[model samples]
Target: MEAPLDPVSAETVSISADQRSRPYLRLFLISFVLLFAELACIRWFGSTVILLTYFTNIVLMACVLGMSVGCLAASRGRNWINAVLPLGLVAIGLACWTLQAYERGEMSIAAGDQSAPQEIFFGAESVQQAPLGRTYPIEVVAGLFYALIALMFVGLGQVMGRAFNAIPNRVAAYTTNVFGSLVGIAAFALAAALQTPPRVWFALALVPLLGFVTRFRPIQVVALVAILFLVGWLPPARNGAARQVTWSPYYKVVFQPSTAVIETNNIGHQQMASIGNSGAAYLLPHLLNRDAGGRPFEDVLIIGAGSGNDVQAALSQHAKHVDAVEIDPVMASIGRANHPNRPYDDPRVSLHLDDGRSYVRKTSKKYDLIVYALVDSLVLHSGYSSLRLENFLFTEQAYRDIQARLKPGGVFVMYNYFRQGWVVGRLVKMVEKAFHMPPIVISLPYRAKITPDQNQAGATTMLIVGKTEAATAAIREKLAESGAFWIHVSPAKNAALNGYGAKAPEVEGTMKEHWWKIAPSVVETRGIGPLPSDDWPFLYLRSSMIPGLNLWGIVIVAVLSLAILARFAPPATTRPNGRMFFLGAGFMLLETKGVVHLALLFGSTWIVNSIVFFAILVMVLLSNLFVVLVRPRRICWYYGLLIASLVIGAFLPMDSFLALPGASKVILSCAVTFVPIFFAGVIFATEFRDSRHPDVDFGSNIGGVILGGLSENLSLVVGFKHLLLLAAVYYLLSAAFKRRAEPPAS
Candidate 1:
């Protein structure tokens, strides 16, 4: 019973045990850092790089690419984990600072005699418009920057993959990884909850740094200190009198005292001027006086009540009570603190922080006035899809729901700085269709002068929709008495008829004239074109036409990256099974679909996104635990269950859920959406457990995620629900390709 081991053998056994234990810790640290980095990229990089905000999936795809490269490297027995991790952190940090400086207009380059080129990387040219015409240079530079970011991720991925391969119990390692990810999410979320700025977020990198680099050399220590110092020191520039800068869950909000406007990442969001001085107030008197017929409004509802300016306007109109619904809490808080009107603190105002459309649907009480005031989002809903936060609010059905919320003789007024004449025409047409009557459209210029030649195309447009014809007539009369320049769009002719009278000759081809008379018909005849619906809410994009050059460029880069990966990390001789690849692709599609669907149901707040991501990880963790414990023998059963769940989800009445109580709606939606996700997890775990080479399998899975990210763009062409069908097809393909395995020896 007592055969003693030789000294050398005993030492070797002790070292092996120590090595085994060390990797679990490494796995946890790596997982935590990777997730933290991901969130940082999504938030920090997204805010700084304008294109990143529009095409958010690019960041996800880049991360996947890097991680895939790293995992592939691990499979080839090449691990540069320690050397690459810290360098990657420093690289990303510096890139973020440089981008932020450029975005703030601090960075400049002399081109010939010009101080700066007409088209710079983070200039106005980057926003809203399709990436066409002289945009290639910007695109090239952005692509290279993103590629570097991917390379950084590759290093982290290699570290993680190495740790994962070393651990004998894959399930245990996976659990630790998931747990660490949750911690990362929680930490970042907490920082956001506290309104931590970018500097505080940068400091979070130290957690992983401390864990991984226990014995840093003098040079390494100096580099780490310098990086941290730069993160804190590199101040974000201000446009006007920058009173405060803070991070909301969804945006980086800045309050400028001189302008009295709240901005999201330097873009104007909410004007906080006094009620008398505000541009928004121009439409208020018209609505209150004309629709109310001099009677005081008993109750008012203001959607997108940013900075409480609209609420203050309502209060000034002697509304007895006001319901202000705003989605961003940090923005609301700024309104409370910095608004000169102090409308939020008034007893008459009851602020509800929620999605505007969701509030409209849920509220039982009706109001005399419903104002949709300057409610546009600065950023798109998701990078992959051309949807926005306010997309649901502008839909035709949403207008109908809003119409239903109006009391008898009540008025629904909307004011926006519509950038194009066609956009103004489109909103007017939508209102006419909803109310069965043409709206009274007024064009208010930013400056006091109203020249007939002045292109009213870009002016602040207001639509006053009346519940009754009498109310409309009264509003029209009041506007005429005030000598305001307004137009009544002829719904049938699609012509802009002069509302001011024959005394004022119509300015031909101007918004005052016909002003793109064919805009509405063009929109209508296009057959669901850019007009947003609950199903397809791409409000920012004008059409479904894909940016051909941009799409092709991305594809080329992906192909080239793939070639490089192939050259460096050759696959195993067994041809490395592709069943896992399909499963990975399908799973990514499901996750993207879920994120979008949930964003539509709930608000597309940062909290909602984080929660959805956390929920997905938890679901995957549960699936792995189930497989590890139950060890299901029939993969067919799991696949069948997955398909059935998806089918159920596809047919579920989403509108019915919207009508339920808030908690009930959330619970039901989660059940319908996540049931399929759970089954998908089970299927993946079943296949992944049998993988001969975990590193290669993991890399393949990540590679599939890149394809899934690209495929997500399909949502723009075919609405989001159809994406579920696409995902199901991928899952079916996975099932078809799945190689059957013999039962484990009994």
Candidate 2:
């Protein structure tokens, strides 16, 4: 009967008080579904799309942008809710098909990541690029997928927008939304915990989505089936090649038993074979360790011990105690079940399913030999940021920790097909800096095309670091005595070497020989380049700045986001609550800072991420309750508190906290990390309590999240600690922009 007033626009919803309970329940359900779907989209797209495995934040920002657009569309009475299924199918189907084409080497749909020597993308070079003018270049493929992912989630956002408008009490409605989102994140975490496949993720998301539809057409039914079927089994090349897919918390692990090879997120991860042929690379480090005089490394620690090839090699080398540390359980299980040598089943082998850095921090027993065996993570640590899982593992701080774990005069070996000279050179410098001695770096002598004067550059390189007097000296003496101890490379080229022998693998003739002692030439000549540290751990990046590909991607996303908002969002006749927008932006930063801060204190593991998300949500819930019950006044006071908290956090350094007692470090770290978030939540909840147009206002908030996600990239340059100051500025902007308005309706 009432043409209700929505202050932001002329649009009105004919919602009644009696309709509250069901609509609110539906709102909760819709929030749950959408959050779960968003998480699924991020994970699935990162794992399925070829180049996007390194672009998780793009997926995240797309979801935020989509939500903002869909929520704003709510006031226009346009419903994309029914389109969710079809859009989702299109997004998933497109990814699957593209991935199939990629797998078959039929197409190149990369994200302008190729030709990037400044950053390392594992499979970018292998992608067959289409000519720039002829085909829609693979670079644009990521943008297309970004739009598709955004479109897929627009329906969920629209439903939430509608539900928010249905309830008269804005605070209650928002609280419900937060609670629902909390549940949704938890649900996804549970799914991750269960190690559910993509099909189960789709099914879980589909159940709540059906509640939003007034009636289910046959098209919807078929689309639902298509979503499940395509996501579960499409990209037949991937499935058929692997025969089985295991969803780890961090990746889609494809174990190809027939080939004894493992792939994660569409990239070659590791191979499980004996020490005779392909596995000979693993035995090189042991052979190089001449401390026991051909007796082998007695106590070995292999970080990133994927599929037990190194462990197998260790046992073959007669390692008395082998501590094999692998981060992924699925990868470990694959090794245990199918590794030809059955390394994990060996009595002397102790497999630790934990982060390498964390394990190093906790382990007190020094190792006779330590190996970093092709330790590269194809995926980022958290979807919220552009940091890979292996970033921390390669930092100077990490190397120092490894040094502590190594027995005095013990050997530390790192080998990988570095592809770039700068990477190899950079690693050599970090090793020298940490171990206080130059490492014996064995790599084909070549200059980096991108980096100047990096001698020991491309191909498979081994860096042997040690205490000069004992293990390393023994190896150095062995190199001079008979030159038969070997590099971290076996004499058998492709064949796995059964044991040590005085045989050099044939090299391509008429090429320069490798330099066994790779000096820090670049560091001395050009001044040292930025080395990764705990504060700025970016192992793959050439420097602290964002890569060219990422910069271009960000610019395109910003432009597209503007265009989408201009086209689909509610008319710009009325001004949005700027405070809400900035508050949303600030909240995003706070959450990001909390995640990173805690990750530095704890390990960058999936469990840490889940707990941080849960804790942040819980903080929001508490803040909402405080807002409703306390009915706090003066948004300025809350802003002050938020800024104060951020300042306090900025002053507290991450590395300094590592020495604190375990419980004490966690308490102090979480407080510094989350206290600012609580204040931001309070400010948002308090202001939201009296909002005139819930849909428009909430949509504006989502827009801020997109900004925050974009702003997060600045951390690459400024580091995470300084982000606190940036967040503080945002809260200040939020406070400055706050409108003088009417008091509470009560």
Candidate 3:
């Protein structure tokens, strides 16, 4: 016998050929299963439950260990996998159990009106919530997941024994590692350019690249290029579809009041005009001057110090020192850079770059006057007046905390933008509870924008003055003088100001008015709604509609995606497999998810427009060029999936939970929206092996990512939630394709 014709070479060739088909089919199945799971879980449970699912990290670690052990046992022996399986399964069960808690809707903080501010210490037990999944805290779950993956890798490596020796030649290993690093660097760079904050999301997008590149197949490079492009292009592309079209950098500016200016660039114009007319500015000087008002306050605390107007009032008074806490770094920078009154430079003004609540915790310094000149409502980013953190900031506990920071003769003044709505009433009650004094609720009228009706809900900026002492004639006299100095808060009524006669409902300690209903009409108004043509979905869809000849600007992206995918394709083999498809799909999905989620949660007027017209094109070109140049293997797929899932599951659900009614509905929607994305990542991560021509696979995966981003933005025009269903259908189609292409089992 010809000694079996040295069949080892033939076997190697066959295996190499088969590898190309493996990943493609596997990814299709994986994506399908995951997508189905997402829809099913969300439909049944709700977003809250899905958000809570991050706590399942406890179980995931165990499951990973079990999976690793099982894989090891298949290769090494039964004993090893079996030994770890019990513990792993137990952990998985525990994770599932913990996730179930979201079903009960226990995530929201309890409503309370406890007065008399005391120090708050979250304590060991309360800190249990720390590791609970949410966007900000996703690191907790991601870090744990990574640790588990590392453990599994180490254990698996041990089981491989001699087989591990044949892993990669020096050249192959170095090349693969470099490719992997490049993929990671490219994905992160793309994510960063898009203004995506540090999270597991970037990691997940790179998972497929890691797996495909490891196969040493050139087609893997295409996957990397696709992913990068998807992320780079999707955001800008969405901007193209907006309805109202206008670009005004003036929208960002802050200016003084003037009717001559039909549209002022400055953001503070409306407030300034209202304040100026109300005679609040005139009275502010009087309140500050001790000789005039006999106001004994030596120091004052001001929050939301917009345009430094409040600081100017403080400077007028003989305040020993004034502490102002403003959250927006941009506002602070702008004030220092351009504001006539540089509060940062003011001798008496000590500017604090921190949230009001957080800053209060660190400071023991007492102030005679604490003025919360915050925008009538609390929204984190740029908005006229929002109710984002209103509950926390206006609570009884918060007021009491403010009281603790005040001196014996101190007064706490809150000027809120409130109509005679339930929000105002609740606020008054909450403040009364803290001080044990009836609020001297004075109505200051100004015509501001309203919700449901663009111009009319008759909103008035209400001044609810609370002091330790009763307001006598003398106090009223002092308040009148102080009101004159603060222009935004008026002492007089104008026709421009809306009426505030409607009685507001009372809010109790345990039983509170519904936030939405009682939420003041003032807060409901979408302050300066998203600018025309700046709608996120519109931008993406518009970009896509541009003709290729005109869209030739992103030529580099097209080239890169094709080039990378080409490089990864097995030159000698015909079939396409695991090393290719997963990377491609994962990349696209990552880009899509990030852009859509960001646009939805954060205000996207300027951002989406800018991305569509400018940033994305540059990113697409850069991503393509980068992939064509460098390639790596075993891209960080496992870690990426783990992180992406944690971020989406934890943070993304807040909107749905807030938007939807029932706990189950919220949880279920969240699960459906998130799970499919998570599973897509997992499939990509599962491919952690050496490959051929890592660059090609790298490019393909990246290109896919670019597509994913594009798809997300396009989905915006089609409908945000509807896109989730579309994603599911696409995954199913992919799965069917894979099943058809796959060979029959032995």
Candidate 1 lDDT by residue in tens digits, 1-746: 21111112333345667676788888888888887877766666666554455455667677777777777677555544444445655655655665555545545221111112111122243233322222223345456556766776776777777777766555666677888889888888888788777667756754455455435556555655665554434254444344566788777776777777676754557767766543334334433353325576668899998888788877876789999999889878988988887999999899998888878877889878899978877766655455677878876777888888988877888877655444555566677788998776655532332232223344566677777776556646644564443332322122223333223335544355432211011122222235666776655444555455346546766765666466546554424447767777888888877877787777677678778888988998998888877877677888888888777776664455666777888888898778888888888776666544666667777777777777777776777777777788888988888563322221
Cα error, candidate 1, residue 290 (Å): 4.6
lDDT of each: 0.65, 0.75, 0.36
Candidate 2 weakest ten by summed lDDT: 1-10
Candidate 2 colliding pairs, count = 4
Question: Would you estimate the TM-scores of all the predictions?
Answer: 0.82, 0.90, 0.36
Query: Candidate 3 at 269: error in angstroms?
Result: 5.8
Which should have the higher TM-score, number 1 or number 2?
Answer: 2
- Reference-based lDDT, residue 81, model 2: 85
